[model samples]
Target: MTANFSGDNSSTDLLIEHRREIADLLQRIKNRRLQVFGLYATPIALIVTLLAWAGSKIFIWLHGDTPTAVNSVFAAAVFILGVASVIQGLAEFGSGSPWEDSETSVRGLKLDLSLAEEKHVLEARRHTPPVSDRQASYKERIPGEIARLRKESRHYRRLHLLMQWLLFISSAAITAVTAWYDPPQPAKGALIGLGATVTIIAAAAGYFKPRERAFNLQQTADSIEQHTTALELGISPYSAAGEEENLKTYAATVEGLRAEQRMREQQLDQPQQGQQQVI
Candidate 1:
């Protein structure tokens, strides 16, 4: 009876350990999803508010001094939107809450760690007495799990693209309406120039959306690979002789790539900041 109790206690301990690991892994996944949602949603909201402001301003300027209560209300609404956008952008920029892409990488690491732990547990279970086969099917579905994650990532990318295009369309429409209402003349050259600048910015954003998505996807994938390799090396005790070395090499390569990307982003952002300052 003592031996039976000891065996049951060991089994219970293993079950508790597994459950704890699973719970941690699930929490990381939830956090990652939230981070991605915030990344896309926050930017889109700001862009829409900016476009509304720009559109209303252009309309008011085109139809000067004919101000009715409706126009005043519309202008107030646009001003409110602009103020809200500034607040939201400041919050996002200051807190860096929504742009927490690193959290996704952390979650990927947790998943990889969970997987390695699972492998260790399975090996231990195999060496011990027979257990039920219920968990085997779930383990076998890892490919499906990966596929689902990839699909979700792609969906987020598509949503980001859609938002970019919508911003571009709205900006373009505003510019077009402004030009139609008051064509380019020497007297209103400044207004025409402002409209042209807005249109150009919108066009550039639309053009760059695909490139940005590609870059972000590559970065995210590289992060996942690095995290996975690190977790595998850290957790798996019985890996092949060179597996640890390989993982280290993989991680180093990914880190180098990420550093290069950061440098490039900094270079790009500097000029944009300078331009904004000048403006």
Candidate 2:
């Protein structure tokens, strides 16, 4: 029941080469994106952690018997850095995840190419037609792919949003404890931890962009499912066409949707902020 991407007897080296080239390009792009993300996260996390841990000393330096205003200036710098990190983190988050997107593209391409090869084999074997079991294989396979995509999309979406909400609640709790409750030294430490956590979460969320990823995945999956349904029903493109022709049409439609998804991911990779960052 497995479909091989290695083409049928007529497949040319040029075609296989082209597909490999595309896959390689996608992998490179994904690697570059992950590097960029790591570059952004590392320094931000380190500096923020340092500032949070030194909260007690900084507070003492700012408020205690220090005649000079140097501590005030230093504290301001830390605050600025923290804010900047949050902004950058969020920017990176919405910029899209090249790794997952690339994986999706490469996966779809392989499946599409394998299906194409399968069609060729079936066409060639017309004189000695395959069994009904062979025909049933593809019918079962397409839905399985659709289900996998949907499940993965939902998993990321839910995990990210859940984390974001939890951080927000933690932030709220810290703000409330410090502003209204007049906490002691131990409680004050919690405020510093809160600031660090929020900054990290903000940056992480920006980079992760779970909601958009999930939405795009769901859309692509739904589009493919629709086409599958149409072909099964013998609709316009699928009707009056031979099995091979119908499959080509289906592959074309699915590929188009996947291309759209790629374009959308590219657009997201840019530094978008303000209202655009909400989702």
Cα lDDT, all candidates? 0.57, 0.67
Q: Which digits, one per residue and each the tens of the lDDT, describe model 1 over residues 1-279?
A: 999779867876776677676776676677666655655665576577567656766876666654477567656666765675565555445656544434346557566667957865884675454322332332244335435545655865776676567666656666666667665454366555555766765666654454454555456555555455454555442244664454454445545655665554454445566636644
lDDT for residue 112 in candidate 2, whole number 0-100: 58
Candidate 2, residue 104: CA error in Å?
36
- Per-candidate alpha-carbon RMSD to the true structure: 16.6, 16.0
**Tens-place lDDT digits, model 2, residues 141-199:** 77887898799789978978887797979889887878775654667877778888888
Candidate 2, residue 50: the lDDT equals 65
Q: How close is candidate 1 to the true structure, as a TM-score?
A: 0.32
**55 in model 1: Cα distance from truth in Å?**
1.9
